[model samples]
Target chain A: MKPTSKFGVLILVAPAVFIYAFAVLLPFVGTIALSFARWNGFGTPEFAGFDNYIRAFHDTVFVSSFGHMLFYIATTLVVEVAMGLLLAGVISSGRFMGYPRVALFIPVMLPMVVIAVLWGAVFNPDFGAMNAFLSAIGREDWRQVWLGNPATALPAISLVSGWIFAGFYMAIFNAAFARLPQDVIESARLDGANERTLFWRIKVPMIRQVSSVAMLLCITGGIQGFDLFYVMTNGGPYNSTEVPTTYMVKAVFRDMEIGFGSSLSVILTIVGLVIAIFFRKWRSTRQEDVEY
Target chain B: MRIDPKKLRRLLVSVVMTMSVALTSACGSSSEEGDKTLRIAFGSNGSDGQKVWDQAAAKFEADNPGWKVEFQVQNDDLYQTVGLQNLLTSNNAPDVYFEWAGARLVNKVNAGYAADITDLVSSSGLDQQFAEGAFGTTSVDGKVYMVPFTSDVTNVIWYNKDMFAEKGLSAPTTWAEFLTLCEKLKSEGVTPLAVGNKDLWVAGNWIGHLISRSAGESVYDKVMSKQMPMNSPEFVKGLTYLTDLQKGGYVNASANTIPDNEGYNLFLQGSAAMLPIGSWLIGIAQEQAPDINLGWFNLPAIDGGAGSQESIMGVTTGYIVNAKSTKQDKAVEFLKDAFSADLVGAWNAAGFTVVAKSADAGTLDPVTQSMVDLLNSGASIVAPPDTGYDLKMADALNTAIAQVLDGVKTPQEALDEAQAKVETQ
Candidate 1:
């Protein structure tokens, strides 16, 4: 009966496993293979060995986009997680909590394409709402060509990313807060722990695992940012706002250099994986075993 | 009914398979004759040009029985980027598609994406109808790869006639005079040039013009063909000239950020006095700013330059067939009708210049009239660098131009970097 049960379980999972192999694994392997071949998305692919990877290392545009992604990830970590934790704490505190959760999460619910294009208009240097507000506030000098200047473009784009996904991280942290041991929180309050102390000292420490997960999600999302940059600036003003994903698109689709684009993709995947693993290891070392 | 377990399983599987087949067949039946459909893809040229294409598609379908023509109107940027590869590799590739004839077309031909149509043009006598040297870019190793349809002259400075008159300024004929005029306009608190460098290609147009004017036609041709490097002193001089314009307060403050449409619109609204744009602006101006008295002039010659002022920068955008298309003959037939006198007349009426000499140039609006005069007087026509180089190299050059405008790199440094990248490619 035990052997039969194992066989039944195998049969049940076979379809999903086959689909994963066909759809995900197959294309991934194909991409890796094509990364080493010189194919322009047409005709027969020529063997190019490590030439594509070699070229990528020397590519200034690729390097610039990679640097931009690092800046974006750093900002996302600070903005999304920090704002998310604050909102989650306030919402969980039951202060004006009657406001629906959907209101805060609305930006996350909107499609990324919609958010990017909306932000693009908002960031328009002339007649955009951002500059208009600055002028109305008598801060006209503070106004900038947000997505147009090479110096300001990446940071401006990062602000939009943080705005759109802060809500998503808030939802994640809210769920974690809801699952927190109410007995422990109440005990801390009874021990004369103020709301701030409880939130920072006890609640934060208790939800370390959840916060780690949220950070990991934000990191990966920032590293793979494409739609926002593609819609807003298209990595323009001399590729200042470029990221790994947008650069890959330009190489593969725009430039018709499949090998170079695929190589960039592989490098992006490796970078994401390494950062995620490092984060996991770092978080695990600080994690404490808790008993109910 | 009672049944064995294995038999019941087989019966269920068969029933599911039959249902799935029926569902798939229903969806596939509508587009089964998609092969018979002649798909023509073109860059979106406002609504008027789209209507012209639609009419041509209707006329072509009417002329040929048992054939359906589908018009795929795509945004220009998308068509040149992801859309191109997707169309070429798909089973239902466009039978006829728009293409810039030069290194871009050559890249497609080398990759076996473009069909060789040399014999077809010769047998049909289509070559005789086009102007001399019209097929130069479309030809690779003496074999025609595409057919020219639309032609344009770039680097034409479109200025507001009323503003020029109010300011007591005439179009300058030399680079020094142009600088003086710009300075004069600046002193009067007017933005001398409404530029949109955000699009990159808009800036690329100026670079191509300056190079052609500074380096001369012969030298520019050699540079484009890779016989000489792009980091040559002539190119550096051209880059310096462009940088000086930006530094001299001749261009708008928002030049780096504004989209091309907004910049050109500023000129139309009398906010800016001048616009250095291609011939296509004539049509747009005619539609959007009909009341504004618009005037155009060729890019001024550099002081003591080797190039003739008459060496104009231009390009011929045309239609090319898919190499793997099964209905090549039918597609060529559609192209013939698409380029017929009636269709060409419609395009010309819509403010386009057709390459076919027999095609009418319409009533010749003042702007178009100036363009025609300038093109006719050209000693040699040089295709824009963006057209003559592959997209990757062109992108590098565009970036270099932007960096120069941003004052991040000196002219020599930028050109040297761009030339280095091109050489490696």
Candidate 2:
């Protein structure tokens, strides 16, 4: 077969490269430049050097927002990725036959705004479903203003994020499970490997690459998560649930502090990239690849 | 499909040209520079708000042929998020737009977005149509930039009169009496105040006023102007009242979570005995719970309060034409028609407290009439912080209040936090 010419390859890939650069790369470069300026979304932007970055370090709200992001990442990893892995394993073992895959994925299909509205009612301090459920169970002491309390808000938001995305991860894991070598599993089963043992030792290890990817998505998605947090809490109860995005939005749009907002965005992007790179490095062990 | 290099080069060039044309067309605005249609952008008011605008448009169009009115409507949150800062800088800035008075109005003028309408108003004697002091709020640097539309009595104790009567209670007239009334309400197992402070501005406006009364207007002015620190003793003393309300459990447990509408609804549905909101509540109640009877009272007098005891937290909203617009005259005429007898009467019938002294007294309902009477009663209107001063400073102040209200921190500590935020800003 004839090899493609260099110019032909360049011509073919040019559109995709150009679109990527325009959409992602250009804005990223612009944000970095804007991070050093003092702009209020009007008039000319004045160059302020590292003032915004310096301010972010000294500002409690800006620094605390990352703390919220970490909690969000930790909670979502467990609920979404781990829960999905477990649910997939349980289904693959035929123990959870009654729960349909379609039913599980339904929450993932709903729009985020709809989800936020639904959960907002659910966590509403006065007459929300969570409080009602708690009262009905004779656990009135456990009732809480879920989204209002600073202590509970970030966790509650993470739980909502998990509820929406868990089934998505489950779908991914289930598909990966289906493609696993049946002969090895049958061999393990014949050797008196129980369901739990099979899942833990055989299946889980075989899906290392998939698990790595899932964790990567979870981390990056957590860093970028804004909508539910914005709609449900809006970094309120004194900026308790403020992730970088919400604070960025407030600074740029609400406060008209565009320079500070751009700095926050740049910080978020860098954090996302760092986490992705670190995860890739940690997951790139040559021995983890299982040969057929 | 594989092609020769010469043909491929030509193809790529054609594709580039086509893409540029497509992108250019996509970016082109629907309204051209020479368009006869005039734009007036504003946030969502209640359904009746549209009626007033429509009447204004119809009136304006009837008199001025070959011209049309277009409204760019956005939700309140969306409007607040983008606001005039983004709009004025954009290519599609509204020719006429609704704006709040005070710092926001001044900022618009400072940025040259607000057209000076003093000449327009005085020359036509339209300035005489407004109630006394209405123009003051809409003015910046001695130049009127906005035409006063509605003066919102921003924070008032809007009580369910039916609930009060059933409970054998009346509106309190002083701080001590108000606390006793709150205690009585709590003993009666009724939430005294349903505050949705999630937006910060809801109860923040009231708290700002309360603090202003306690701290004195001069101290309040200094702090808001950033001449004095937010964590000053005067501010802390003013916030003590809020903490008292919070610790007393007179406010809803979910005050920090729910939006103002939900809190107002809680009062409207008789779930909560009182809601400290604004004159705007009537507009919302008229739509959702029309038959509900509500009564209004200013913030009760504080003992030894440094400011005027009868002060009320309020702000005016008005429309301004773009400074750069060629249709400035047309926009001003459109604004005049919006305040014309029939249109303003429509506003009053819809329960809005129109700022015009010329608004028909008979058009106002009892509750609205009482509000207008309060204005006439020589009560000082303390502008709410969000619109009346720097938004960031207001936000920091509001956050401090929320922290204290939620049992998250002491008033002094919260104010310190606010001071920290202000310093960073």
Candidate 3:
């Protein structure tokens, strides 16, 4: 390209760059700066280099919140991805299922807060559908306080979250499966490649990129899980279901510790960036140079 | 390059139109209000309080021809959680609003956000009319910052009279008898106390009452003021009593998971024998379970404690004007009119124990009347420990207490850690 044309392109991109800087970059920089100060969101902030970070380090609540996020992310990744992939494979292969896939995907279309409230009702200790079902099956003693018990609160919330998002992942994998070459599948079938082998050897390997993308989305979303936990538990039964974002909100807004809250947000941002970078590198290294 | 002038003109016209629309909408929304309009924001106090406030506002507006009152009521999540502090600091704070008394208001007052109402109270002769402790909560550093609206009697042991009768029980007047009653109630397959620690404050109510009983009102006052350590022997003994209540199965094992409504429901449904909550529970009991046959008594004294049975936990919810209010004169006028003899009488008629000289104590609900009598008859009132500590210290202590109730930590361990936090803060 000519130098004058390059200059013209740069001039054309100037407005977009300005918009990004004002809208996104400014807030990002402000948050980072605030992380190093002691602010109560009401008065003048005092500079306290690394003090907020040190407080975050010592805060047992923050540590517990991190553990909660990890548990939620791991359980959600395992359940949603595996179930999504299996269901996507089955639905794409012209199985016995007809409207079942559509029915399953309905949850993905609903708002997460609605899903949380619905699940909360279903898990009600006294008069819940789950308890009713248990009583009908002669297992009344097995009925559990699903959202109230610290032992089961996180898992129950994770299950609701997974149910809400799994359908989206399933739809993604299903679309990816549709774009796969039919000839390879036909040839594999002709060669007596069993159903399991076809899925494992051909379909799975082909959709590695889609799975990687899905996993990345899951990781980022899981790390920032706030609304579901907030609506369902508010990180209670004694902060047992707390996540990083919830903890940050409680500190910044509830306790008026804006500085410490910002530090937590910075930590979350760094962890998210590291994961994204690691995944990008792994993706690039694993990519095959295919000529079509 | 050749440009189509028509297309260029059209694009320019569209952009101009969009900008104009945006500017117009902004201006339309930004229009200023009349000077007579007084906007107040308060936490939503359920349907009953809403009705009473609505009636009062209507009456206020009707009496004042040109003045208008705009009442904004939201959930506790919005008002009590964090949004209230934000509102107080911002230019958008209400002219007058209800706030939790004690250290919560003290923080705002010390920050110079609330107006001093000392002159108003004195000139208006409210000091003589209101209860003794009513002026105490809003007074800080010799200046009054708020007007007490209603007093909450916090040591009331609301019990199901039907359940007590069925179990052949009577109200216990001493600590030993209270424990004996609890044991008997528990052995009879009823949860002795339908206590809920879900919101932390619900549990704090019980703990504060226990402290008042075990440590005496003076010790509670000193502890709340931070003159005594939280881990002091008296305070520790109070917590020990609470832990024993938990261990003895007097409290619901799952109470930590139950919210206030659910815990109240248990007591209402006869699943629990007692619920030691505020006198406000009387209204709730009347509304939810009118036929439950309820009775209340002050918390009994411990055998070897210095406290008297007359001591109780009492805090008043009141209104404060914004220090930066443009209509400060009008706000004070509204307060004066609102707390007038007729208005206070109206409030008394509406079941509230209003802190006004004009409030006819005899006209209050039977329960509220009794509570007023209790307050007037020289019952010692103690504020919660959090009423003295800073915001961070208070929240940390409340959360730690919740954890203790969940069996995550012993009372001593929790108090020790909480003490360290309070001292640091």
Candidate 4:
């Protein structure tokens, strides 16, 4: 009976295991092997173990680009998560003015590329509504070279990205908030708890699991951000806005250094693994306060 | 009451097998290949050129029994790079494709991704058809890798002839004279140069010409190759020239934010006096505002500089065939026949200036013809900066110029940093 059960279990799991190995594991192993070679994607790869890594370490653009990614992640985490939580709390309380929650969440339904194009028009220096508003207040001096100046370009791009993704996070938080037990909130209210205390003591701790999951998603996506920057800047103004993904792409496709680009990809994967592991550990250590 | 485990398991297995079979069947069908079909892929904005090529291709197919050509147009977005890479890797590259003529093509040649057409050029006698400098761009290691199709004269300064006459200004012949003219135009409340520095490449053209003419040709090449530091006196002079123009209020106040079309629009409206751009601007001017009286001249040299007075930057658009193609012989024959004087003449008729040395090459629009004449009369023609530098160094220089314009770094600092970066590469 035990042998039959074991065989049954293996049969049930084998197909999924095969699919995962073929789709993910094999390509990953190939990438790792390719990272140690010198290839231009057309000729035979010459073995140059660790040379790609050594060169990557010395590359100033790649180093600076990684630093920029961290800076972007930091800013995005604070702004997006805070905005999402605040908006979710407000809508969940049923005291928000005017619009329905569904109406407020409509921006999340639009595609990111569409949103980017709309914002591109709005940010145009000459005929864009942004500069028009600046001039309207007789503060024409404040009109900025928003996307053109190096100092402001990255921040401006980040603002657009935050705006696009904040609503999606807000919807996630809203759904999570709806699943929280109402009895706990009611008990807190009966004990003369203010809104802040109720939120901190009851709601926040209850949603910790969801929050951690959301954070993990944000970190992974943030690390892999390419489209927004690619569309807006293409890492312009002296590669100030470059991310690792864009750098890897330029190296592989534009420069035709396939092996070097593969090495960069491996570095990116390692960085992602470190972050995921750290987050998992943190989540595990934080005990769940909710009892079913 | 529960069903037997083996029966349930078999039922699930059968369902999975059915789904797999269905998916495989869905993906298995192939479209019928037609014998007459000849696939041609080209970049966007080639409709006019495509019309001529389609006519020629149609003629060729008609002459040959049971043959037709199918044109496949693809936008030259970032995907072109990806598609080309994939094709080269798989040894399934297109028969003929339009490619930029410098480091962009050199990499393909170095990897043996492009077919050697030495026989095609010599046997077909096209080696002597194109101008001497026109073929230099597509040559790698003393072997010609592509056939020149169109000429891009980069240092031409296009001006509104009527606007210049109204402002009592003549085209300047020296850098100092140009600055004086700029100051005069600015004092009269007109933008002096309609430049779109937002694209970075537009700014690069100005910077490249100034550096080439200011420091002379060889120094420009050295700077581009990173042998000379970007912070060298020559580069600094180029940056200072642009910065001074900005400070003097000679350029559009929002030049960095205005796109190429908007700047060109301003020029067309006569709000700006001059536009330093390629000869391609004549086509744009005709398309956008045909009523505007436009004229072109070579970019002026620095006063008392080592550079010749008539030095201009030149580029070419050309064709390259796939090295691994089984039909390489047929492809070579097609290119040789298609790029003859007749086709070259058709291109010239469609506003392109062909480099073919045939006496009956063709004619362009009157204004464009004049610009081509001016290009023909130039004392020297310098290759664009990217043509001289390797891929990495070219990107580094282009990016550094943007940083300098945005004031993130001083001209010296930007050049020094770029130099440091490129040297390491």
| Each candidate's fnat | 0.46, 0.73, 0.25, 0.41
Alpha-carbon runs more than 4 Å astray in model 1: A1-18, A98-104, A129-141, A289-292, B1-4, B12-41, B44-76, B93-95, B113-116, B321-333, B359-362, B423-425
Per-prediction DockQ comes to 0.45, 0.63, 0.32, 0.35
lDDT of 2: 0.86
Ranking by DockQ: 2, 1, 4, 3
Candidate 4, residue A83: lDDT: 72
Which is the better candidate, 2 or 4, if ranked by lDDT?
A: 2
Ranking by TM-score: 2, 1, 3, 4
Off by over 4 Å in 2: A1-18, A98-100, A285-287, B1-12, B18-37
Model 3, span B1-425: residue lDDT tens? 85555555566557657866886787566224566778788887667566666666777688779888887677777887676766666545678988768877887786667898778667756566565656776778878888878777765788887778877899999877899999998888888888766666777766776776787877766766678777777877777777767568688765665678878888898888898787778777778988878788777777777777677777777888888788866676677667767677767666677777774446666667788887777766777645444556556557666766656678788778767655643
lDDT of 2 by residue, B173-193 (tens): 999999999999989888898
**For each candidate, what TM-score against the reference?**
0.89, 0.94, 0.87, 0.87
On DockQ, the stronger of 2 and 3 is 2
lDDT of 3 by residue, A1-292 (tens): 3444444455456657868997999989999999999987766889989988887877777777889998998998977887788888888878846688888799988888888778877877766798889999999788887776889889999898878888888999999888988998899999999888988888988888889889889988999888888877888876788899988887887677788889999998998789789878988798683321
Interface Cα RMSD, each model: 3.4, 2.1, 5.1, 3.4
**Model 3, position B334: C-alpha lDDT score:** 72
- Residues A95-192 of candidate 4 have per-residue lDDT tens digits of 76347566656766787677766776677775678889999999998887676666777888778777866777878888888888888888889999
* Cα displacement (Å) at residue B398, model 3: 2.8
Residue B33 shift from truth in candidate 3, angstroms: 12
**Greater-TM-score candidate between 2 and 4:** 2
Cα lDDT computed for each candidate against the true fold = 0.80, 0.86, 0.77, 0.74
Selected candidate, larger TM-score, 1 vs 4: 1
Clashes (N, CA, C under 3 Å) per candidate? 1, 0, 0, 1
